[model samples]
Every structure is written in structure tokens, then in C-alpha cells.
Target: MMILSWRRRRGGHRTTKAAFSEENLSTNLAIPTHFLCPISLDLMKDPVTLPTGITYDRESIEKWIETGNQTCPVTNQVLKTFDQIPNHVIRRMIQDWCVENRARGVERIPTPRIPVAPRDVLEICSNIMTATQRGDHKKCMELVEKIKRWGRESERNKKCIVENGSGYVLSALFESFSSISIEEHKFLLGETLSLLIRMLPLGSEGQSNLGSASSLRCMAWFLKEKNLSSCQNAVLALKELLGLDEKHVNAFAEIEGVEEALVKIVKEQICPKSTKASLMVISHLISSSTSSENTISRFLELGLVSMVLEILVGSERGMTEKALSVLDTICNWEQGIVKARAHALTMPVLVKKILRVSILATDLSVSAILKLCKSQEGGGDQQVEALQLGGFHKLLVVLQVGCGEKTKEKATELLKLLNQHRGRLDCFDSSMDFKYLKRPSL
Candidate 1:
């Protein structure tokens, strides 16, 4: 036993020396776990800002950013770029810096004071809102003319003095402007808060573009409502405002801050049975799947999927469909781990249900089948070909019968690959019709 033990120790020493040999591998070792985002601990995307308002796109890119006066996302102290993140032994122990998010800990910002209201407040507000609702440009222009008479009045009278009634009327008036002039769309996002006093969430009139409690709620409501007809340009405006495009000005306005805010809300309300707010936030993230692939991927890495699925398991079908659509988008990428995670999370019963249904244009069935084949053990020739065959058949049907041939050539090539490995095909299913799997011309 001693002789055997001595031999084992000597062999272990030899193996260690071999591993360290310069001829075997590069001395510059890759940081296995550190290749990911410090915040997400996943592959980096267009890195974003937290409440600390610090942003970076890449590590070296981050170094060039002036984060000196800026505070750290994990530590509140004023920051410089962290030079030794991967080298920090404590980072892995705490599960990346983002686990202690600085965004959530940001102090409540005071609402910015709004410009004083117009005198004859009720009259001007009613005229503007009425014209906005009717989509009557001449009438709205007429109201704008009348508004010149009231100048700036006391804050109390601005939106509160609607002559006949308040509350529900004002809400309806704002809601009615899902279609309105470009200027009116801009006015509503900020001004709606002043109009929404005595409501559930107070407006941050002085603070934000969608400042007040009421305005944020209204903004949240608009974003969450699935009906296209019930939406507004404010969403587009907000996002556009945040984006670097002057051309997209009108398209992404009110939703810019709202998107960032939604992420914060999702993290904040993480508890047993949070109200509808968290679910609404998840819906927005899923809705944004096609917004930008990198941004969507970043959102996923920030823990949106698992948290959403956990809390909103019995959510409406629309929500589930949106989530699945996002999964399809992520899975479309070659060798995306996010897709792998999504597939595991999608229950077996759900997969079966999807298969049993009469296939629709939007059905993700082919993608799912391809993914299944990729995951099978060995990832060897026969299994890979079978999966590609399933995808090819479905894609062909879609091109021939449903959609056009945008991806048909790619599908055809995949079919050709199946044939290349057809010799190895006998190792698997006899039902795989290799005779029909034609080789594509190079």
C-alpha cells in the first residue's frame, strides 16, 4: 500500500509539472469566470448605467470613461475604474458586484418643481385636453391660443381646477390621447402629472419628465397595456430621448427613463406575491426582445427571466407568449447559452402542448426541435443531422406554404449537411428518411 501511495504522489507531481510546462499552454491564462459582465457575470453587451449613472460598453472602453467623480455601482464612494476586478479574490465569494446593486440603494430624488400653472387653469386645461382627445388640430391650436391668456398661476389651480369634475375625467382625457399631435404627445408626458392630483401615486412634478407619482403610474400603465390602440408616442419619445439619435426623437421619448425605472421596480418588489408591478415590468422586457439584441441579452442577464417566471407562473397567455418569443430570439443565435437555459425552464408539458397544436407562422417548434438535437449526448453526426432535418422540414413547409424563402437556402444547406453524415445516420433512427435529404450544390 505504501509503495502504491508513493508512486501515486510521484505521478501527481509529474502531472503538475507537465501542466506548468511552457510548451503545453499559454502563460496568459484566461480568467474562466471573469469573461462575463461584472454586473451580470455573463457575456458583456452594451453595458448600461445604474442609479449611480456610471456606464461602460467594454472593459478597456470603460477605462477611458471618466468615472472619477462618479460613484461605484457596488460601493457608494466616488469611483475610478476598477483595475483588478478579476484579480479580486473576494468578488467571486460575493457573487459579482451587482449582487449588491447601487441602483436600488440610491436615495429618493426630490421631485422637480414644475413651471407654475396657467391662470383660468380649468378652462385652459379642458380646452387642451378636449382638443387632444378629438384629434382636432384646429381646435387644439385654438386652445393653445386661449392658454396665452392665463400666463403662470399658482401651482394648486393648474390641473386641479377642471370646471365640472376631476380625477376620472382627467385620467380619461390623458388616456384618450393615444393618438394626438406630436407636440401634444410631449406635453402629456410631463404635464399629466400635475393634472393627476388626488390619485394613487403622486406626481414628481418638479423632478422628472414623467415626474409625479401619477405620471409614473400613467407611464407604467401605458407601457403595460397590451392593446396597441391604447398606447401613446410618449414611450417612443422617452426611449428616443435616452438614445443618441435626434432622428428618433418622437419615437422613444417617454419610455427612456421608464425602461430603466422598470428594472429598478422589478428588483425592488422582489418578495412573496408582489403586486402587478413586477409582472408588468417583466412584460415590458419581453416586449423589448427585438429592440436591440445586445440590450435584450443584457436585460436577460440581469435576472429578468427566472425572476419573472418564478413570480408570474400563472400569468396570462399573452405574457407567456411574449416570454417564449424572447426565448426564440435568444435561441436564434449560434450556440447561445441563454437559449439553453430557456429551453430547460420551459416545462415539458408546455413543449408537448406547442407540438400538439396546429403549427402557426410564429410557432417556435422548429427551433425547439433543433435545440433538442443539439443538446443530445455526444453532439455526434447522426443526432445533429436528425435535428437539422426536423428544422429543415419545418422551414421548407413555411417557405413553400406560409412565408417566403428568406432562409430557405440556409435550410437547404443544413439538409445537405445531414446527407454528408448520412453514412453515420445508421447508428440512429431508421425512420429518418435519408433518401429525401438531398445535397445542396456548393
Candidate 2:
């Protein structure tokens, strides 16, 4: 497709004739934005060069090319530009780039860089501090010669943080954010957050040293900026970037509305996949944020309990481990969200799930239920029935069919719990395959 040259720039070239040129437009135009740029027509490199020896920014080319600038690649024509390019083209571009950048292997690896002297680094870090303090971010950035330089600078700045006063300067700048007009503050905060997030990653794989602790302080500070819409997004983006889903519990503790946002991500993104991978993330979050009782309660209200149960009994061991871990949080933790009160709990979904897993598989699950049953004077009669009718027999079989003596301890405890009704002793033992369970006294 042909494109008009730099409009007001010296190298600008405007097409004289018109022709339909978008031969690569995707087959799915109604998909909101896919058709904006034909996926089939990919530009491996940016500052796309044209057959006419002219080049334009990818975004600019996409805009003007859709306005009927379709023409021979060699000839300048006004075939298409905006009429063909829907208003959502920009949206498509961002989604496409962000997704592509996020997908592994799509990003090019940077070449290795030689190290700079520590004293030289200190001199440059001092300037970065001065520039950043004066709000000269551009000049500060120019100090780093390569991507690796960010780490070096971060380290140097951290070591002599007292001498350069970066911490004080940054804190002062952050204060200015709240007092400024919302729009301007947002823009400034957005840049500040972006820099902090990138600088905050755990140092490169197998690095000799860790990234500066000060960088973490900066990143954590950005996370605390939940008051701004963009900053909130930046914090979430950082969580995603570092795979620190669990960290948000603490990272976002002071940030208002983060719990709701995190719950939304799990409900919307994590649960939908239901893959062992997604469950891994959820499990990590549950473990990291041990005290998110409110969030865990929201999960059940969001109808996530069913999904968690399904994963807990699924064949994927990793997923089951994660799901069980989450269940343990709600059912066993000191401040559990899933209370022992089983008033209206008529459904046996949780029971069925535990029953489905191998006797050994529900080890933690059985423990969680046992913890739930513990009360002030100890579990009551109804709680005992809850355990029995809730299919606590899953562990009974572990005792009866003690082929591997897997739940030997658990089985004994469960039996003791059932010791309440000596007459009902037969009822509990009946569920077990005592014949196969006997692994011999030895």
C-alpha cells in the first residue's frame, strides 16, 4: 500500500493518484480492531521503508494509508487512508504491540555491554540525581549508554544514596504529585511509575549482584500511588511484569481499591483459564497475601469456589497443589475466610472434590477440615456430623486401605473424632476396605 510522505516535513511525498491497496487486510474486520492492520502483512522492522524509497513511522503510515491511499508500492497514490482505517486502528496497534511484546521470544535480546568504572559511574549517577531532582529526566536518561547501565547506575546511586540525596529528592517529587492538577500530575506520575517499575525487576538472571535496594524503594513508592488511575494500572502492570501476583497483597496494602482490582484480575483472567499455570498464580497470591480474608470471601461470592474445587480434584498435580493451597488458606488459616459455620451448607461440592483426589492427594485438605472442626470446647456434635456426612470417609479409606500407610496419622485422628458415638463406630469403619488397608503389623 502507498502512503503520503512526511506531510509537513522535508521528505514528505503526497500521492497524486488513488487505488485500492490493502490486499492484506485480515478476514475478520468485525473483531473490533484486528482488521485495522492486516496481520498477514507484517513489518519485521519499524521506520518502514517503502518501494518509493520513503519511510514513515508505523503508526503514521497506518493512519494515512487507510484513507484510500492504496496504490502500487512503487507509485504514489491516494487510494486509501482513514476511510478504510477505522478509528479503532490505534487501539489495535496498542493491543497488538503490547501482546506481542508480552509474548515470550518476541522481544530481541540486547547485546552484552562492557562494564564502566565505579568512580565514573558515581560521577554519572551524581548527575542523574541532580537532573532528576531538577526534573531533567531526559538529561538523566542520556547518562546510561545501554540497558545494562540502568543496573550499574541503580547500584551506584544506592551505595552513595546519602551523598546524592536521591531518596530525599524522589520523596520530595512524589509529594508534588498530590498537590498538582490531576491531569498534569497524572502525566508526570505515569512517567515516574514507568521508570520505577522497569528499574525494580530483580536483577538480571544470574547477575553477580542484585539491583539496588533503593530501586525497590522507588518501585514500592510507585505502587503506593494508587490514587491515580494510571499509577494504579502501573502497579498492576508491575505485578504482571514480575509475576509477583502475591506481592500485591503487601505491595498494594496501603493503596486503596487494590484488593478489588486484584480480585477482578483473578476472577476475570486467572479463573477463566483454569489451567495449572493460572492456578499456580492464584495459589501464589493466596500464600503471599495470607490475611486477605475479605478478598478470599469475595472469591467465593464471585463464584470462584466451584472453579477452585474443580482444579483441586483435576489430574494436573501442580494445579491441585495450588488449589488445595488456596483452600487451606480459607479453611485452615488462623483467620480463615471460610468459617467453620456450616449453617446453610447443603451442597457437598467440597466433599466430592476431596473424595475424588487420591487418598494421599487430599492430605492438606483433610488437615484443613480438621482445623475447621476445632472449637473452644472442641468440635460439637453437629460439626462431627458435618465431617462424616461431608464425606470425611475419604480419609477413612486411607486408614483402612493403609497400603502405603499414607494417611495413617490422619486416619487415626479421624477415627478418634468419630469415637463420639461408640454405636456409630461400625458406620465409620464400614466405608473403609479394611482387607486391602492392612499392611501387616510389621
Clashes found in each candidate (C-alpha, N, C closer than 3 A): 25, 21
Residues 223-253, candidate 2: write the lDDT tens digits.
Answer: 3444444434344434443354344434434
Model 2: residues with Cα > 4 Å off, grouped in runs = 1-128, 137-251, 270-307, 310-319, 332-363, 375-412, 418-442
Candidate 1 lDDT over 152-213, as tens digits, reads 44333333344334334344444445333323464443344334432423223222333333
Location of the lowest summed lDDT over 10 successive residues in candidate 1: 1-10
Worst ten in a row by lDDT for model 2: 205-214
Overall lDDT per candidate, in order of appearance: 0.40, 0.43
- Angstrom error of the Cα, residue 134, model 2: value is 2.2
Cα deviation of 356 in candidate 1 (Å)? 4.2
- All candidates: TM-score: 0.33, 0.40
**Which whole-number lDDT from 0 to 100 does residue 308 have in model 1?**
46
